[model samples]
Target chain A: MTNKECQWGGEERGILIVLSGPSGVGKGTVCSALRSMSKDLVYSVSATTRLPREGEIDGVNYFFKTREQFLSMIDNEELLEWAEYVGNYYGTPKAFVEQTLASGKDIILEIEVQGALKVKEKFPEGVFIFLLPPSIDELQNRITNRGTESEETIRKRMTAAVEEISLSEHYDYIIVNDKVEAACNRIRSIMVAEHCKKERYLPKIKKWIEEVL
Target chain B: MTNKECQWGGEERGILIVLSGPSGVGKGTVCSALRSMSKDLVYSVSATTRLPREGEIDGVNYFFKTREQFLSMIDNEELLEWAEYVGNYYGTPKAFVEQTLASGKDIILEIEVQGALKVKEKFPEGVFIFLLPPSIDELQNRITNRGTESEETIRKRMTAAVEEISLSEHYDYIIVNDKVEAACNRIRSIMVAEHCKKERYLPKIKKWIEEVL
Candidate 1:
């Protein structure tokens, strides 16, 4: 956004927010609360080859795609980051994200750690945040209590959670989800604080100095 | 302090805050408001060779020092940063600040630009913040209208203000003091957000991951 239109007084285009963690870390809930609180946040919809659920709407949930369409996107290099999970392809569309940010709106991409790292490779300026449960016991409780998954799947997910937690150090911020509201508040504070970082706002201040001096 | 003693959730020792700005930028007003708002913050008491005004208390206002003691502190390297101003020595006492932070209390040192850069050289981990007035006009008004200072002194201060503002790019955070309360709130946000930085809390999270896995 132009410096005049910036809410955080930054002269940069917009921030790309990348949120990642293991299953049942409450990324969806935190993002929901964040989007509800911030009117300017745009959620990046992932194009997936998985079939839609009974009531899930296309685009509103995932951008439902055939395997052929998803493969085509990958071949055309249109996806920011993508991976195959449980025989389904899931990836973030790059064009929409670029447009949204170019229009001066922040966009959040909720993905797994692998995808997150991949996106970071392509977009190093993105704010990468890894969300975690308060403790291992809490994470286990959440995963086991999600009822829809089989016991075998839960066991595998627990193993994966440990690996994901280990990779959190690579992210810019690691937020422990004690409560959705508190987690959201901390994320919002990070957003505000990042905007105030010296590098981001130096140009605007320099402009002010130029005018004043 | 041990990481376990930290209240902000990071394992690192309490943050050393370095606040610097031009003379007429209302640093005192903002700091007063900040102290009242955050009872947890400890203001670093500087040792000054200048005689204290009648009502100012020792240790609370300043650690009133004789010129000889001040020179001794310089020789002993007992000051984090020190400078001579108006024929008097004013400097942050190293012993008190290190002691307070060892007890897990955040200490804020308010100094000028040169002292701040010097502190950064010695303690590179400090969270340096440069405060600015809302506008040049407001800064001029504040300096010129301070009835206690002569016009020549005001002119000198204005010149210093420009130079200091130009050096702000080196600071970690920059806050514009439009209103004391707002400035205080932003500073508070920076404190909270700094605790969330991945680098600060990685070891703690790593311990958690090791135990959980």
Candidate 2:
């Protein structure tokens, strides 16, 4: 048996899981529960050109950097996926994710549709899971209950959601967040199953077979 | 929400899970546990031309078949995969497995490596999971403990195991049968995760999107 605490067949590399869905789908709640559920699971902390807000630690909250450094990373192809959001470059740092996975920890990336698709281009084997609200009515209700958005803003979000769902087919799996705990469990199950995937154990298994023979 | 008793993303067609490994790798134990673990799971009863031994139930033990009927099934391509074993044709019934799946029940097929691979060629979408022992030595120990096997038979199986492990990379997932219960849980998790696969929901999701839009 390999040193992995998870009892998979071979020495398994940590899986990269990209989770994407529309707003008001309760992704945050389910991801938080997942973090508590598995100690081996890590949330990918993105690097940003924007300054960290109050009480935000450098690496823990976000890897805050100047515009020059952030742009430098993009030029070096160090970011898995990056985009300008409100004039600040926010992106998943490739090094951070690689280092975390190298340490035998599975990383879950909660990102938007574009970013998730971009990550797929970079890491084609990554598991892409799309989270969906139970129903459109429930999704609208959840958005409205937020009370922070104007009706116009809510309508804009709903429109965006429809477009987001249209792309859900590109994902490897779709998780309906009808219940928070159930959704978290489903993600965890996906993680475990991914570990058993043939791609992860190919090299090690080939070597093991030769040695055993 | 779909009629699936299991809460997956969409109405899932029952998946045909083909489980195969070396003879003494404890697939029987894991699969038996799985049958009890999920009531929705059904074991695929193979059709064999060999006469049913004393006290053997026709449909329950094996679909006891005459050589003529089995030959006709082969001609009609009714058997998904078949093999001539000791002058008797043993095979999986395509109709039975399809009907079981169409009725929204997962069917587990415990077959040899050749049969499993054959089934994969026929049903490319079926989940092919390779059950493996922790190591070659442990596998020998297991076969030895079986007392029913002669030393030569055990040695033959051990040699066969090396080839099987080499081919395990062809499987969708590999389950290490370290602990029976743990292996069972891994299979169950794989089943749940497979249900959430996007390919299973593509057509339904498109229709759902059109309706919602």
Candidate 3:
């Protein structure tokens, strides 16, 4: 890092901010708000064997891949985390994340709790934030307000949310998704603060001191 | 600790932000800017055996104390860290800091690197930030700008700064003081992010889930 870049935001590796939460929490809304707030953050594109829906652009929306290509990627260990859902394979390509970080561009990964935990195992340094509904009642209201679901499905989802929230202890940070803007701001602050972490800049500072001072 | 307090600003114990750096690193300037930016942070007043200077208020500026009082406090372990300088004693009172934090009010302690390290030993959870000049040359310029010092004193201070900076590895974060506003922003973000730390809120979250969910 140059002396001018020493101010901040000059890290050689970008931070991976993983957003996860229970089903009813506003992780998607918060992530979208965060994306609008900062152009510096890049949203990680997922690679999937599922066919791209109409109006979806490859590489922009998802890295559309054939079943054989996805299987080859899995064999080569090119994916960070992969899941088989509804007979389709979906995964995050390790190459894009690693390249973005190497180029000093931060990437945001919004995934389920299990997927976020899987990412954590691969990249322990990633900042994992668990988005939470304001209250259990609030989560119930949100789940019910999505009127498309049956009562049985809502109950099942609520149980799943509680189970997912239990695993929140493994996350690095917890953000209550009471307000979308507030949650996004918390995420923004976390990103800024993570850059200031001692481990990220200490070696560079040490080298700078040795060479210049 | 409640559902209403589950958001980012609801930490039970206020954070202790300890700002420390080498001499001429603009720690004071950055701290002052931070104070102006947020009224939520309280400045920790030092207890001193030295007589209060003109216009200095008791308790507000410094907690004035007699030599006996200071010595007794030291013996009683009432002080977080103490130093005897120029025939007088000065120290941070552990009570005031603890009381402030327990009241859910964050306190800022701007001290020398040695004093900061001492506080860290006593309260390792404190957020230790090492402020740095943009570059070694900039640090030299800042030191030289203090026109009252002799050339010999300047050289001594430069040596001291280098030695002090070497201890920055012990700090939790590093902020380059290129601009006071920017440095203050980093500290603010750090304060915000620290509140979101999972360890601070996970227990409450778990209890909330158990009792309410």
Candidate 4:
């Protein structure tokens, strides 16, 4: 409990850590590893118009929605960020993330680069982390190893990956996915370090210094 | 090692981490613990006109200097930050810190707040961390526990500590010294997280994307 006070000041809302990168850069794997490593982090499940895959439960894997419902959420500004890809709509529902953070629990959002950028527009305070492959060859190898894409689709993905990487300067931190465990550790470090930032805890610190002396 | 590129980009200078806070905030203890845990961080030895204490070695504990020698170093601007304390001149020698960082090894400098502010003027890129006691009463307790200071000296230290803590808003991060091991771990997290900062590696990442990809 002593360390808890030191971990973060009392009564502050938790941080939103946005994990994004080019497709196939292992964002999901790293985020899952990070969450497994630390119980303090809550994953922000997204909503999608796309049909659920086998065994994917609604609200657990994603908030499966109809296209009309997803569009309505977007129109009402109830979604933090949304994008259409390959003929299906995907978005982050704002209410759950807001409620979780207000309760002082940190949340991790693993999303596409475009969705991450949109979230940054609305929540500038969010910690935007850009994941990266060890190299282009490695990224290509990852996509190839998945064995789901055609040669033409692979080329398109590589080109899109390059474009996404170019926008990395817009992120707060970069984690190259050289190894899953190492990338996860770096993310944990980033989370701890963000908690220590003066901007987040200075008011509480100042109050403690001024009042309780 | 693959992780080396991920640790830091090629050929960039290492960071300088400045650890400073109030007089009795346990900055030194936490820093020493940090060094013991991390082999990569080199501790910076300061220069002083004050005579060396028992078992203190020249260039190890401090670069012991006469008033004349200290004044000359000040005249030549060889010291990064110098202050007169208890009628003695104390300073951080500029050369060693610069050389260590330039050679791509981080250096930790634990010093008074005044001296740290001076170092900030010279090395703006350095990571400035302010250590804090859990509370003012805790800080007073730490000073009292030292047993070397008289009542009047303790009062003076408490006043100075307050003034120093008020300036903490200028720091990049803050670590409350509730527990020494926890504080050390937080400092280590700051170091690791600083490497992940986009500002530190954006150019390298951009170049990699453009050229190597």
Candidate 5:
């Protein structure tokens, strides 16, 4: 009964949580709030062939690479999932995510629906979460209020939002981003609950039983 | 979007949560706290073959029944789970639990390990929780301090507690009975998180998608 054994000693399995959403759904804000609360989680950085924007660090923001290097990665199947946009290629490097998880840290990959599907294919154990606006009207208002894009761009994004919302069924969890704090708390609760799963705690329980009995 | 549909329908599929612990581990206190916070949850009243001692109601406290009736239930397999103690049979009835769950109300069943295993065999989806004392020495002290049992009974119960703790591995979650409020809060959090699982919420997501798309 006085045993001080650290019961769960198997290789630390990392939780891979994918956050997917339509534009202007406040997914970024909710994720930021979650990050502020939990320091053990890491956000995955995407590798891209496009040039880095102003004040963006190469490895921190995006792992900027040449077109030849990106294509070579695809040829070698080193990328877990990849997609092309405009004239550049963007993909998640398999090694980075695997290493982060192996070290017992949770990793969040913020990707679009297409890329999210590919990631799920590559890592079947990853948790997929979809963020939604409270309503279509609220979605429109949010996009319009951002004022960062031209009216034409906003309209195009709105159309894409509709399509993305239609695919929310593919996600494991649907969080309505009506309020950032509430959404973050719900996500955090999910994380805590996952940790208490019987399968994950079985080894510890087995050891406790063997020693006591 | 404002439609408030009971996504699971009136065809309720409520969860059955089983709480078990050694005596003096504060299980009753924790259950009372949980009930106070979650008024919607129904605590299942068990049936017993023992004669009523005092002002106990048939349905509210225990469904006091004749020994022949209890034996008849056993023959008919109407009891979800039961056990014999001191020449009296105590058990949970199947009809009441099923009817309550079908009405969309969560149910809590407080029973011992044997009864828990029986219920698990019948309903594998049920949530099984084990309450643990802080330590073996503390458990001995708590039981001894109760002053209701003889020294021989105390020793017997302590040995039983050890055996029960050894079987804690079978439980889905283990709540340490350090503080009643904290344990109840964790239980509530687990319940809320279970509701958010993909298997339960996927239908709502699909319906929303089909309607909007």
Candidate 6:
């Protein structure tokens, strides 16, 4: 079939990209780089009841809300996925994600391994990506260099990192964050490759075949 | 778990890679490039009953077998997949593929869509890749430019090309052969990424978690 004859119909499926990594592997940096490269991608702003930290903006970093509103969402099952953490509620709203996807924009969700599994359950088509540090020493160095946590916390976080790394098996793809550009390129390539899958292009292929034949 | 402590186990599932494209799309060229980059890859040699065209080596280009052997294989279901074209039989041996993968080598099976789909049915975990020319015009130009086929044969081949392209949607990945090096890089990256999938790494991950915790 001729490529020109193939007509793309309706809204393309919104790709659900789940990014998870060790705390210091720079997943946020890779995600930001990806966002800068493609404006069509929407970073899914998670909903939370945690008080906005200093300089954090409402609806920008998160949809910060009252405990009542958060509980109400949970009650109505409006959130695609949610989790209670450190006595505060954090969740992904269904409406915004659906709206963003319907408009043909890809959504990127940076969440932990556990949260990612929950999101995957709700959206089975979501693409799961696990980011890894080059080595344990590198991961330790990065965590220590951050200076946000004490020695005890660092050890605890490292233990948690190991647990998270174990869940790496559940992810669809794993990117060892040896270099930001290289990792971002892999992610971008995966996105491009996914779009070319048979399920996505069969209709167009069929139409093109009929025209050329 | 540390890389030193992590043991490669029997749980690693085999990856089935299917390579297909229009004639002269350089599928063989790309496959050769891929093999050069990874020495552990096992290239599946087809079992065929065709007389060896000049310079064709038995068990290299194909497993040259007699009609009786080929028919017996088909009857005994020893072939993973097979197809008859004109007066020759071509099939992939099931035992060789299973043995190659069990030894941890990535298997690359260069087959047509019919054979590919049949193998996929038996091994649903297979990765299917379709190679395409940069454009339809370029494809037609390449086919005609070869001067090997007459006008009538070219027309028949073009129709067949359209049919094959229509089935491209069944593939997991579609690579446009615009540039050889770039296509090779993407294909290699895909193989690396596939190896890092959670399904392949989960056992190691589970062990790592146990060690750390």
TM-score for each of the candidates: 0.88, 0.92, 0.95, 0.91, 0.78, 0.72
Q: lDDT of candidate 5?
A: 0.77
Q: Model 1 compared with the native: what TM-score?
A: 0.88
lDDT at position A179, candidate 2: 80
Q: Which is better, 2 or 4, measured by DockQ?
A: 4
Please state the CAPRI-style docking class of candidate 3. medium
lDDT of 2 by residue, B1-213 (tens): 122333233554688999998888988888888889878789999999998899999888899889999999999999999999789889999999999888877899998787899999899989999988876678879878878888788778778877877888789998888888888888888887988788776676687778767
Clashing pairs in 2: none
**Model 4 backbone overlap count:** 0
Off by over 4 Å in 1: A1-12, A50-59, A64-69, A148-155, A207-213, B1-12, B147-156, B211-213
Model number with the top DockQ: 3
| Candidate 5, B1-213: lDDT as tens digits | 111133322124677888887777888888888999899889999999999878999989999989999999989999989888999999999988899888777889888776788898888888898877766677889989988789899989877887777777777876666677777866776675555555665565567656765
Say which candidate scores most in TM-score: 3
The runs of at least 3 residues in candidate 5 whose Cα sits more than 4 Å from the true structure, single-residue gaps closed, are: A1-14, A22-24, A72-78, A135-170, B1-13, B21-26, B53-58, B72-77, B132-171, B174-179, B208-213
Q: Share of real interface contacts recovered by each model? A: 0.51, 0.57, 0.66, 0.58, 0.24, 0.43
Ordered by TM-score, highest first, the candidates read 3, 2, 4, 1, 5, 6
DockQ leaderboard ranking: 3, 4, 2, 1, 6, 5
Q: B1-213 in candidate 4: lDDT tens per residue? A: 113555336336788999999887888788888899988889999999999899999999999999999999999999999999899999999999999988888899998898899999988889999988887678889888988789999888888787888889888988888888988888888888887788876777677766745
Candidate 4 ranges beyond 4 A from true positions: A1-3, A6-11, A52-54, A148-153, A209-213, B1-3, B6-11, B51-55, B148-155
Which residue pairs in candidate 1 have backbone atoms (N, alpha carbon, C) closer than 3 angstroms, thus clashing?
none
Candidate 2 per-residue lDDT, tens place, A1-213, comes to: 122443233444577899888887887788888889877788999899898898999998899999999989999999999999898889999998888778777899999887899999999888999988877788889888988888899988888887888898789998888888788878878877887777776777787767767
After TM-score superposition, the amount by which residue B1's alpha carbon in candidate 6 deviates from its true location, in angstroms, is: 20
Candidate 3's residue-wise lDDT over A23-120, tens digit each?
87888888888999888899999999999899999999999999999999999999889999999999999999999999888999999999999999
Residue ranges of candidate 2 with Cα displaced over 4 Å = A1-9, A148-151, B1-9, B148-153
When sorted by lDDT, best at the front, the candidate numbers are 3, 4, 2, 1, 6, 5
The i-RMS of every model, in angstroms, reads 5.6, 4.4, 4.6, 3.8, 6.5, 6.3
